[model samples]
Target chain A: EAGVTQSPTHLIKTRGQQATLRCSPISGHTSVYWYQQALGLGLQFLLWYDEGEERNRGNFPPRFSGRQFPNYSSELNVNALELEDSALYLCASSLAFGTNLPDTQYFGPGTRLTVL
Target chain B: SQKIEQNSEALNIQEGKTATLTCNYTNYSPAYLQWYRQDPGRGPVFLLLIRENEKEKRKERLKVTFDTTLKQSLFHITASQPADSATYLCALVRPGGKLTFGQGTILTVHP
Candidate 1:
């Protein structure tokens, strides 16, 4: 089966601009998660979407937001991007939450966002 | 505040040896702990998951041990190979499904 896929392997945006990153989850998966990995840093949770609803979010600012579509794909939008926003944006998908089994997330290769 | 810590930033070992990595958390009671492998410029791949009720789990040459009382997890690879070189991340998942990750430990198995 095809794993989660993300678009635009690399993206470059100037400061104060808006950037949009897209992700398509694996087939039959309904939960999509977004994370940011800064240079030399750990992965930081960004957003969680399940069944077209925003279930949770991390400590990121409001400028960082995203939405999940009916088909279970997701888009992450960064408004007025800053140099600090330059990082690798990763997307992951898993089976619907609250199941009897563990919800193990499968990740896409990720988009490298470079904010100048 | 919830915090997760890996044992080190990097580990180097000769091939065919056993490599052990550690993950510890503070101020959090996770229902499950997971390990993932991430290579440079790629997303993390799921490795193993151990629940609080389970003390240990193994898959092939990989083994994971979870200690709830100490709030720690240990990941081990026996007879390691150069292919095992990568950053290993540990994540904690709460009962509600919120996951918090730690800074990964980069393992280098030299041939």
Candidate 2:
């Protein structure tokens, strides 16, 4: 089975620009998560979507947003990008919502966004 | 609010020895604590997941111990090798079912 797959393995954008990164979750997986892995920031959760609905989000700003599709694919959008936004944007997939059974997340290779 | 913490410093140990990493948390309880291994320029790979009620779980040479009392989890890699050198991350299941990660601890196994 294809693990979670993300588009644009690497991205480069200038300040004030907008960036869109995409993700396709594993087959039959209904939950997709987005995380930002910046230098010194480790990995921080940005959003969690289940069955195409926004379930939860992290402390990230409004500029950091994303949406999930019916097929469990997701896209993360960062607007008015800043230099600090240059980091690895990872997308993960899990089973259905509210199910904690071995609720481990399977991640994609990630989109490395570099905002200049 | 719940906070998870790991050693920000890098750990260096000789090969063939056991490498132990720690993850500590404060405030509420977690349903399960998970361990992940991440290489440079790569996404994190799931290592092990131990539930709150479970004391210890092992897979191959890797072992994870969860102590809900201490609100901590310990990850161990026995007979460590140079290939085991990477950053190990710890995560806790949040109230809404999201996984909250801590700052990973980089482990370097000297040959």
Candidate 3:
């Protein structure tokens, strides 16, 4: 089966601009997760969507938002981007909850977002 | 608040030796722990997953030990090779599937 896939390998945006990154999860997966990895930093969870509903979010501000489509693909939107918003945005997917098994997330290559 | 920490410094070791990485966490009781390997400019690949009840799990040359009492997990790569060089990350999974990750440790194996 194909793994998770991301689009626009890289994105360039200026301060005050908006950026959209997309991801398609593996087949049969229903949970999509978004994470941001800043330069020299670890992956920080941004949002979690399962079954097309926002389940949970991280400490990030509201400007970091995303949604999951019926097909379980997801799109991350960064509004009013700042210079610090430049980082690698990653998307992952896993089996939905209550599967009675561990939900091991498979990640996409990620989109490199650069805000000038 | 939950916090996961890994050695930020890069680890260098000769090939054919065992490479051990550490991950320590606090303020959360995770249902399970996972390890991932990430190459530069690439996404992380799942390496292993150890549940809280599992003390040790192994896959080929990779071994992972989870100590819930100490709130720590140790990842080991035996007979390491240059190809094993990458950043290894440890993530703690909450009950609802939220994963909190550590800073990751960079490992370099000399051939």
Candidate 4:
């Protein structure tokens, strides 16, 4: 009955350094998604992993990447971070059954990454 | 390409009144549309879902309307309370199983 959980409620790092954010999906969920929410930018899609494969990604650059574990947890790694990279990183999970899943996505509390 | 949009301005409604929010999209025919509630410093929580074929859906005090022709969705909170204040987001899954979220609209219900 636990919802999605993320580590490092807050993160602070300098520009040019790498940042790693972790996410654990709800129990029994198989699809994990990553999103970045910043001022004015809204919640932008970053990546989607299903069944341990990189299924789809958003308009973000290649430096933004992630992997889903066999247990359905995931990690997002941002390389060459810039000042603009600072934002709340959210992780979501959904059932892999397909369209009938109601397309309902449950989100995590998120990791607030502040790049200085 | 595909895009989703929501009212960017904050909506202020008096407690016990009804609040209406809008979600619109372009360049895609989604099978289903969703509504989520998010609070400050936290991620979004699933609120409701309505399929394209369906006209309306209601959960507790929330009601969602979908219009495929208009490519728009409406979210309504009836008998609102001060605790209802939060940002509401709309999202849709593409044919490829990727979800696209709207910018979200902030709702502030005052007592």
Question: How good is the docking of model 2, by CAPRI class?
Answer: medium
* Predicted model with the maximum lDDT: 1
Two-chain DockQ for each candidate model? 0.64, 0.65, 0.66, 0.64
lDDT of 1 by residue, B51-86 (tens): 889999999999999998898899999999999999
TM-score of each: 0.98, 0.96, 0.97, 0.95
- iRMSD, model 4, in Å: 2.2
| lDDT per residue as tens, model 3, A1-116 | 99999998999989999999999999999989999999999999999999899888899999999998988899999999999999999999998767433399999999999999
User: What interface RMSD do all candidates show, one decimal each?
Assistant: 2.1, 2.1, 2.0, 2.2
First chain TM-score for all predictions: 0.96, 0.94, 0.96, 0.94
lDDT score of residue A104 within candidate 3? 94
lDDT by residue for model 1 over A22-78, one digit each (tens)?
A: 999999999999999999999999999999988888999999999999999999999
Looking at model 2 chain A, report the run of 10 residues with the lowest lDDT sum: A95-104
Ranking by lDDT: 1, 3, 2, 4
Q: Is candidate 2 or candidate 4 better by TM-score?
A: 2
For residues A1-95, write the lDDT of model 4, one tens digit per residue: 99999998999999999999999999988999899999666788888888898888899999999998888899999999999999999999888
- Expressed as tens digits, the lDDT of each residue in B1-111 for candidate 3 is 889888656999999999999999998779899999999999999999999999999999999999989989999999999999999999999876678999999999999
Would you list the clashing residue pairs of candidate 1? none
Worst 10 residues of 1 chain B by lDDT: B91-100
Clashes of 3: 0
Index of the highest-TM-score prediction: 1
Indicate the TM-score of model 3. 0.97
